[model samples]
Target: MTKSPYFPQPAVASNVAITTEAIDITTLFANAQHATAGGIVLFSGTVRNHHAGMAVAYLEYEAFEPLALKQMQLIVNEACSKWSLSHAHCTHRIGKLAIGDSAIVVITAHAHRSQAYEANQYIMDRVKAEVPIWKNEFFTDGSSAWGNNTPPINSK
Candidate 1:
C-alpha cells in the first residue's frame, strides 16, 4: 500500500506499534485523550484460556513488522477519515503471550460516544482482516497449530 500523506513521521509514530513487551494500556489511554474529545474507547484483545474446545496453554504471535505496522496505520487513518476522531492508535504484541495477556489494543477518541465506538470497532475489524499477523495456539495436550491455519492478509 502507498504511504498516507497524513501519516506521522517515524519519530511521532507512537500511534501504531508492534512489540514483544507488554502493552502499556494506561499510557495509550493517556495519549489518546484530546481536548475536544468527549468519548474515548479502548479495546483490548486478550489471549483466552480455551480455543475450539481445547484447553489452551499459551499463544505466540508473529508478524511481518514492516507490513504489519503499515497496515495498522492504514486502518487507523481510515477510521480517522471516516469519523470525527481526535485520536486513534493501535498496538499489537508479538512473541509468546500467556493466557489473559493482552494481545492487541485499539484506542479511539471522538467528540461523541457513537463515533468513538463505531470507529474503534472499524479499526479492529480492518486490522484483523488485513494485517499481516499470524497466531499460533498451543494446547495443554502438547499440540500446537497455526491459528485457523491462515494469515490475516490475502496479499492482494
Candidate 2:
C-alpha cells in the first residue's frame, strides 16, 4: 500500500469563466488545506505566446457556458473517484487575454506528496481533455486558429 501522511477526503469545487481578476490562489490553497495530513498541490495554466509553432500574439477563450460548466463538474467528480484528494477546486477564464494571463487553476491536496502530485496531474489532464472549452489563437501575422480546446476523452 502507498504511504501517505494524510488521506484525501471530500472537497469543494467551483467553476467559473470570467474576464476580470486573476484567481485568488491563496483562497484555493486554504480550501484544500486540511489538518489530517500534509501536502497540497496547485496547478495553473496561462495564456502563452506560441502553440504548435504559431507565434501567438494573444488568445481569446470561449466556453459553451452550460455544457462547459457541466463538463468541468464532471472532471472534479472523476478526480474525486481516482485520487485520495482531500479537496479540489478549479477555475477557467474566458474572453480576451494577453500572454501571461492566468487561464486555469487547479488545487488538490492529499496526505503525501505523491498523492498530491498524481491528483494534480489528473485534474489538469482531465480538465483540458474533457472540458468543452474553446480557444482562439491569434498569430503575430493576424491569423488565428479556433477549435474545441478539450484535452481528450479519456485518461488513465
Candidate 3:
C-alpha cells in the first residue's frame, strides 16, 4: 500500500497542515504566541457524541491532501492579510477518531481581541466551506453516512 501523505509529524511553524495523527493543540498554541500580540484566540473543533440527533459512534476524516493543504494555507493567509495579526495557524486531523477527539484547530494572535476573534472565525468558516476534506459519520445503529458538515449561512 502506498503511504498516506497525511502522516504524523512534529508541529512546526507551518501555517496549515493535514495530518493523520492527533492534533497537538499545545504546540500550535505555543507557536502562535507573539510578544506584540495583546489577544490570542484558539478554536478547536472536536468530535461530539451526537450529531443531528443521532448517536454518533465515531468519525472518520479523509482529505485530498494536495488541495486541502493548499486551500487551508490560503484561508490562513487571507486571515492574516485581512487583520493585523501577529500570528496565524491551522491544523486538521484525519483518520478514525473517537468522540471528543480534536478534529481541527485554528489559532490567531492580534493586537486586539476583536480582530483575533473575527479572524479565527473567518478561517474556520472558509475551511468548512472550501476545503476538500470529507467526514464520515458512523452511527450507533451501524449506519454510516458522509456528513454534510458545512454550516448554513444566514441571509438577511
Candidate 4:
C-alpha cells in the first residue's frame, strides 16, 4: 500500500514509476482518466505461472531508477504526442513477484478507443524494449535466467 518514492507527482499529466511495491491499478486508472477523454485503455502485465514451457515460481525485477524513469517518461511522452491523449501513466513493479502478481500496468486516455489502445500497447512495448529495467525468472525446478529483452517488431 506504500507509494513509490520514485514516482513523480501523480498530478503530472505523464506519470511513471519503478518500485518494489505492488502497483495500484485503481490509482493509475483514476489519474489517467480525464473529462475530455472518451476512452481509457489499461494494460496489466501479471506474473504468470509458466514461461516458454517452464514452470515459473516467481520473478525478480530490478531497474536503474534514474535511467528507467527517464526512458519511461520518454515513452509516455512519445505516445502522448502521437495521439490526442489527455493523460498517460505507467508503473512497473520491482523485487520478487509471485504468480498472479501484477508486474506492470499502463493506462492511456484518449478521445477515441483506437488511439487509446494503440498508445497503451506502444508504451508497454517501448518500455520493455528500451527501458533499463531487467527481470530474472525463477522456475519451480530451481533454475533461473534473465528475462527476454526482445522488442516487438512493431515497436519502431
Stretches off by above 4 angstroms in model 2 are: 1-8, 12-20, 147-156
Tens digit of lDDT per residue, candidate 4, span 24-127? Answer: 88877777757667789999999888777779999999999999999999889888877857778899999999999999999988777898899899999899
By lDDT, the candidates rank as 1, 3, 4, 2
Deviation from native of the Cα of residue 116 in model 2, angstroms: 1.2
For each candidate, what is the lDDT?
Answer: 0.85, 0.73, 0.84, 0.83
Over the stretch 13-65, how does candidate 2's per-residue lDDT look in tens digits?
Answer: 53334334667777766766677647888888888777766688988888777
Give candidate 4's root-mean-square deviation (CA, Å): 8.1
Instruction: List the candidates' TM-scores in order.
Output: 0.86, 0.79, 0.86, 0.86
Candidate 1 error regions (>4 Å): 1-14, 150-156
Using lDDT as the yardstick, the better of models 3 and 4 is 3
Best prediction by TM-score: 1
User: Pairs clashing in candidate 4?
Assistant: none
lDDT of 1: 0.85
